[model samples]
Target: MIEVRNLTKRYGPLTVVDDLSFTVQAGQVTGFLGPNGAGKTTTMRMIVGLAAPDRGSVTVSGRRYADIAVPLSEVGALLDAGAVHGGRTAYDHLWALAASNGLPRRRVGEVLARTGMASVAAKRAGGFSLGMRQRLGIAAALLGDPRVLIFDEPVNGLDPEGIRWVRELMRSLAAEGRAVLVSSHLMSEMAQTADHLVVIGRGRLIADTSMSEFMRSAGEGTVHVRAADPGALALRLSAAGAGVREGLESSLVVSGMTAGDVGRIAAYHGLALSELTPQRASLEDAFMELTAGSVDYQGVTS
Candidate 1:
C-alpha cells in the first residue's frame, strides 16, 4: 500500500499539484487520471521522489522511497520509455537495474521471460520499437520484483495487442497483492484495467473512488429500447411523463424511467419490443463528463 499526504507542489507562481492526498491499496490497480498539464506526472514524480513536493510526502508501504533500503525490492517504476541505455541490450539493461539493488542476475532473465522479451533480450534497446522498449522497461521494473509498481503511461505508443498485454500485466500484478498505480490519459484502457480511480484536475484531487462506484455515480440512468413502433412508443412514453427520443434505427432512448418500467409500459400498450436494456455510459464518457468543467486546458477545435 502507498499513502500520499497533503502532496502539494508549486513552481514559483504556478502550482502543479495542490494538497493531494490518497491511499493506493494493495490488490487493486488504482488509476491516476487527469488531462494533460493536470499535474499527474508531477504528482507521480513526487511520489517516487523524483520531485519533492512543497507541502507533503509520499510513502510506499510504510516509509519514504528514499529512506527505504533496497528500494528496488520495495517499489518498481517505469516512468519513461527512454530510461535505458541506447547501446545496451534489453537483458543488459535489466541486469543493471538488478545490480543496482543487489538483485540476482537471474532476475534479469526471469523478468525478460515473464515480459515475453526473451527473444529480443539480446536486441539493442535503441533499435527496439516503442512497444519493445516498453516491455524492456517493464522487465527492468520487475527485475527487483518489488511489492509496489508504478507505471506512468505504460501503454503510450503501444499498438492494440501490446496495450492488452500491458493491461493484463497490471491486473496480474494487482492480483498478486502488489499495489499498482498507473497514470494514463487513455480512459478506455483504464476502464478495463483499473479497479480504483483517483481523478485529478488542475493538480487537485477531484474524485477518489472505486471504478464501479465512480461509474455508477457519473453514469446517469437511461433506458435503451428498440421497438417496431418507434413513433408510437416515443409518443406514448412521452405522454406518460417518460422523456423518450429516437436512439437508433427503430430504437428509443428513454430517461427518467427504468428499463423494467419501460418494458412494462410497452407491454401495457401492446407494443412489440426488441431490445430493452439500461444504457450505461462508457467509462471514457463518464470521465469526460465528470472532469469536463475541471479541465485546465482545452484542445483548440479549430
Candidate 2:
C-alpha cells in the first residue's frame, strides 16, 4: 500500500499541491484523476521521490521510497515512457535497470514476454513507435516484480487491443494483492478498470471514494418511464415531488426519484407501465460535474 499524508509542493510562490492526502490500498486499482495543470504529475513525482515535498510524507508499505534498500523491487513507476535512451535495445535497457537494482538478468526476459515485447527485445528503443515505447516502459516497470505500481497515462498511445491489455494487466496486478495507482484522462477506460478513485482539482482533493459511490453521488439520478397514460403518470409523479419532463415516444423523464420508487408509485396507483429504465451516470459525466469549477482552462463553446 501507498500512503500520502499532508503532501504539499510549491514553485515561486505558486502552490501546486495543497496538503493532499490519500491511500492506495492493496488488492484494488485506484485511479488518479484531475484536470490539466491540477498538480497530478507533481504529486506523483513526490511519491516516487523524484521531487521533494514542501510538507508531508509519502510511504510505500511502511518506509519512504528513498529509504528502501531495493526501491525498484518495492515500487515500480512509469512516469515518462519516452525517458529511455534511444540507442539502447529493449533488452539492453531492461538489463541496465536490473543491474542497477541487483535484480537477476532473467527478470528482464520475463517482463519482456509479459509486456508482449519479447519479439522486439533486440530492437533499439529509438525506432519504436509511441505504442511500442509505452509497452517497453511498462516492461521496465514490471522488471523488478514490484509489489506496488504507479503508471501515469499507461495507455496514452495504445491501440484498442493495447488499451485492453493494459487494463487487464493493471487488474491482474491488483488481484495479486499489489497496490496499483494509475493516472489517466480516459474516463471510459478508467470506468472499466478502476475499482476506486482519487480525484483532484487545482491541487486539492475533490473525491476519494469507491467508483460506485463516486458515480452515485456526483449527479442526480434520472429515470425513464413510459406508461399507457403518460399524462396521468406524469401528473402523479409530479404530485409525488418528482420533476417530470416529456420524453420521446410518450415517455417521461423523471428526476428526484429512483427507478424503484417510480415503479412502486406506479404500482400503488394501479398505472399500466410499458417500460421503466434507470439511466446510470457515466464516469465522464461525473468527472465533468464534480470538477466543473476547478477547470483551469475553459474553451469558449458557441
Candidate 3:
C-alpha cells in the first residue's frame, strides 16, 4: 500500500500540494484526478522521491521510497514515457535498468514481451512513436514486478486497442494484490478502470471515495415519469415540492425526489404511469460539476 500524509510542496511563493493525505490500498486501482496545474505531477514526483516535500511524508508499504534497498523491486513508476534516452535500443535500455537495479537480465525480456514490445526490442527509442514509447515505458515499470505501481497518463498516446490493454493490465495488477495508482484526464476510461478515486484541485484534496459512492453523491439524479394524465401528474408532483419540468414525448423530468417517492405519489393520486426511469449523472458530468472552481485554465466563451 502507498500512504501520503500531510504532504506539502511549494515553489517561490506558490504552494502546490497542501496537506494532502490519502492511501492507495492493496488490490485496488486508485485513480488520481485533477485539472491542469492541480499539483498532481508534483505529488507523484514526491511519492517517488524525485521531488522533496516541504512538509509531511510519503511511504510505500511501511518505509519511505528512498529507504528501500531495492527501490525498483518495491515500487515501479512511469512518470514520463519520453524521459528515456533516445539513442538506446528498447532492449538496451531495459537491460541497463536491470543491471543497475541488480535485477536479472531475463526480466527485461519478460517485461518487453509482456508489454507487447518484443518485436521492437532492438529498435532505438528515438525512432519509436509516442504509443510505442508508452509501451516501452510500461515495460520498464514492470521489469521489477514491483508490489506497487504508479502511472501518470499511461494511455496518453495509445489507440483504442492499446487503451483497452492498459485498462485490463491495471485491473489484472490490482487483482494480483498490487497497489496501483493511475492519474489521467480521460474520464470515460477512468470511469471504466478505477475502483476508487482521489480527486484534487489547486493543490488540495477535493474528494477521496469509492467510484460508486462518488457517483451516488454527485446528485440524487432526475426521475423521468410518463403518466396517463401528464398535466395532472405534473401538478401533483409540483405540489409535493418536487421540481418538475417537461421532457420529450410528454414525459416529466423531476428532481428533489426519489423514484420510490414519485411512485408513491403517483399511486396515492391514482395516476397510472406508462414509464418511470431514473437518470443518473455520468462520470464526466459529475467531475465537471465538482471541479468547476478548481480549473486553473478556463477558455473564454464567445
The candidate scoring highest on TM-score is 1
Candidate 3 residue 161 Cα shift, in angstroms, is: 0.6
Local accuracy of candidate 1 as per-residue lDDT tens digits, 1-302: 99999999999999999999999999999999988888888988887899988998899998998998898899988898888889999888888878878999989889999989999888899999888888888887787889899999999878998899999999999999999999988988999999999999888899999999998886466888988888888988898899887776767889888888888888999999989989777888788888898886677986
Candidate 3 regions exceeding 4 Å error are 223-277
Per-candidate clash tally: 0, 0, 0
Query: How well does candidate 1 score on lDDT at residue 211?
Result: 97
lDDT of 3 by residue, 98-209 (tens): 9999999999999999999999999999999899999999998998999999999999899999999999999999999999999999999999999999999999999999
TM-score, model 2 to reference: 0.86
RMSD, one per candidate, in order = 2.3, 3.2, 3.2
Whole-model Cα lDDT per candidate?
A: 0.89, 0.94, 0.95
- Candidate 2: how many backbone clashes? 0
TM-score, prediction 1: 0.90
lDDT of 3: 0.95
